[model samples]
Target: MQAMQQQRQSAAPGALAAFARFVLCGGGVGVASSFAVAGLSSWMPWALANALITVVSTLLATELHARFTFGAGGRATWRQHGQSAGSAAAAYGVTCVAMFALQRFVEAPGAVVEQVVYLSASALAGVARFAVLRLVVFARNRSEGAATARPVCVPEGHVLTPAGAAGFCRAA
Candidate 1:
């Protein structure tokens, strides 16, 4: 029981550390992608530029999140990549909506204004993406952990196992 409590406590601190790494990896890719989109927009439609950059950046960021940010213990699996892409799609929608609002409300919004709006929207979506990736995409397998638990002999002819686990005891 005490070990279980300590394990829970240690997990809490890992979340904070993961968030910091998420920011560093994801944020770094996002910033670079934002600039890339801004530059590409000069040659093509802004939406096209955004779509291209989003795809590329999502791939890069997903890899980073799986390996470093979320500590998934290896390269991202296909399922994880698919889930991350789903979240990225939502984030793309958010940025698009933000840019559309900026255009609708402000006439001839300058490059700086566009960049600011895009970055702000991206940041908001990034927070949500972090949660989804941490909780759903790369989360540790609870059932596997439970399966490895050692059974404890608590009393005469009685054995106990960790929560969500099964144990066997001798019939007395």
Candidate 2:
């Protein structure tokens, strides 16, 4: 059916937009967190500083993805916060395991190599984070009652139809 095809087609653009936002926002968080960690490391153990920066940045990144990337309400509810926490925990576990494997087997002999390995692990974990955020954490539940409708954000100049979403330009 044409309607079914259109419906299927409509979601991809929004998903792509969300993915773009996720990558940009996540990269920004990573860069800022790294700088914070670098500064903090001079005053404390590297591990301690890294953990401190990561924790804050992870929470902020979750909120950004939920609000800006997925157009979920900017206000984070308890449920949303919990979901973000869960996603971050899962992502952290994956990242740690990947980094451990790389360190155990690879010839990462210098600071640069170690940083590259870390970044690669983080990037891989980020893919998982995006999946969880889209499918579970910030998903739009269509079955909710009218009274439970979420305050979705629609940027100016984008069209949101029943079959489509908040961050796309409609073709004339």
Candidate 3:
């Protein structure tokens, strides 16, 4: 094992497990938001009701993802929170697009059917969210006493100096 070779966590959970946990957390949030929207719609403006629900769900989802999905706790920075919030907004946009397509192109028979379609769309968004969270927002060395991922120099054109190493790794 050369110093330039990267060392990654051998015990890190597989992608499937992380995705499963993500789905579990997202499903709970989605179910609660759906009910909240329905309950609020009777008294509030439809747009406002939906918006509030989205905001609350996004907040809850971010914490849930940080703790359960990526296993990072007590170290979330403002930048990380911002990215998580942005990912939530992006996922909501995906759901909205799916809903629009369903309503405009396909004739759904009833509200229940529409809800099912929406849930399916949310699942796709969940997958996207999991990938983004794993790759960007909550990515860190959370493994207790385990090896964490490190940067490695590429095989060819490997440089020894710090300045040259940075350039070489990026260029490779």
Candidate 4:
């Protein structure tokens, strides 16, 4: 019983770290998508540009989230990707419609109204995506323990082990 508690305590830090990494990766993708849509809006309709950017950016973000955040890699078959993509598409469509409606109803300056609507809708959409990803897309399997025990390299050669490198692996 004590060992289980200790294990859970130790796992808390790793879970928090993973969540931070996921947020950073997702934020990068969001920023890129926003910029892409904003820039392309000059030539195309904002909705169309936003949809294009969301599809491309979400695909990239999903790979990062699956491998780093969830510690699940071999699970990302084509079918899984398709399912995730469909989920994201549905979320994006709803977000777009909500933002559009807000823009139309909120009688404020154009820029202010646009920003407010997009920010609120994006936040809601992000939470929805996270819930779906956790519950459905990257749902943990029985092999999760084995997978989480291994080390993962973030960038370059900087590696992070499940229980800190020194605890999990040591020089012999």
Candidate 5:
């Protein structure tokens, strides 16, 4: 029971770390996408502007997310980037479609109503994006060779246990 408790305690930090990374990356992407849509919509059709902004922002976000969020430091390949972009695009498309349908029927009398609709749609889309990103784009698979690779260590203290020796081996 003590061992199990210790194990759970050890795992808690990892889970928190991952969640922190996700929040940071998600916030960055959200800001980028929001700014892009608002800025571009002034010069172009709202739909086109939204799509363009989403794609560009998604690509940039994916790179940051893969490196910072998923601990996939050295594995940010074009394929992985593409996969993230695809997931973001799908999420964006769904949001746009829903927003359009709602706006068409919901007859907003004032600017506030329109704003609420757009904001709500964007929030829903963000939820979808995170789900796809966590589950599909950056799926955690123990069998994946990358996950099994030993982490590099920074010099700290004298090696004592077998685990310490393995860490030293990795560092060396």
Candidate 6:
């Protein structure tokens, strides 16, 4: 039981640390973007304003996640950016739907109400986004962590290899 606990702790240490960094980096940008979206909404339709802010903030957050949150050790690649963008689009939809529901229930909802709804939606989406980013977008970061031990793929016909290890071999 102790050994199992230790292994679980070792595996989760990176995830817990990464989640803290993710909250700091992504939450900061989200707060800023919320204000920006609210401000921009005054000049244009709220949806348009939200779309603009979402794009810019998504870019900034992806960069921050790569450098600080996920410990990618460098700038995010185009592929990572694209994948992050996909997840952000879903988050955007979530926020928009929440806002729409607010509008439906309350006639001319006050700024405070709108912000409350928007931020609530954002928080919900953020959790899922963190999962997707950690498990898929920035998976390499976890695999590269020193605390984690990854199985090595042995070459075919290596003397040290067990018969069960054949599953790791590439199909010729």
Maximum-lDDT candidate: 6
lDDT by residue for model 5 (1-172), tens: 5954643443312446766776677766776666667678789987898888777777777777676666554446677778777777777777678667867888764455645666566667766776676677666531364455566554776655755554465334
Write the residue-wise lDDT of candidate 2 on 39-153 in tens digits.
7868997666766776798778877875677766455567877877787776666656755676688865555665676677678878888888788876653123234544666
List the lowest-lDDT window of 10 residues for candidate 2. 141-150
Worst 10 residues of 4 by lDDT: 6-15
The global C-alpha lDDT for each of the candidates, from Candidate 1 onward, is 0.83, 0.69, 0.70, 0.68, 0.66, 0.87
Looking at model 6, the pairs that clash are none
* Best candidate according to TM-score: 1
TM-score: the better of candidates 3 and 6: 6
Clashes of each: 0, 0, 0, 0, 0, 0
Could you arrange the candidates by lDDT from highest to lowest? 6, 1, 3, 2, 4, 5
Clashes (candidate 6): 0
Residue 65, model 2: lDDT of: 74
Candidate 5 Cα RMSD (Å): 8.2
Candidate 3 — what's its lDDT? Answer: 0.70
lDDT of 2 at 52: 77
Q: Candidate 6 lDDT, tens digit per residue, 1-172?
A: 4954654543423788899999999999999999999999999999999999999999999999987787776789999999999999999999999999999999999889888899999999999999999999988655666546555567766654456554565444
Q: For candidate 4, lDDT tens digit of each residue in 117-148?
A: 66667667777777677667776532455566
Residue pairs of candidate 5 with colliding backbone atoms: none
Could you tell me the lDDT of residue 83 within candidate 2?
78
lDDT of 4 at 147: 67
How accurate locally is residue 137 in candidate 6, as Cα lDDT from 0 to 100? 93
80 Cα displacement, candidate 4 (Å): 2.6
For residue 98, model 3's alpha carbon misses the true position, in angstroms, by 2.5
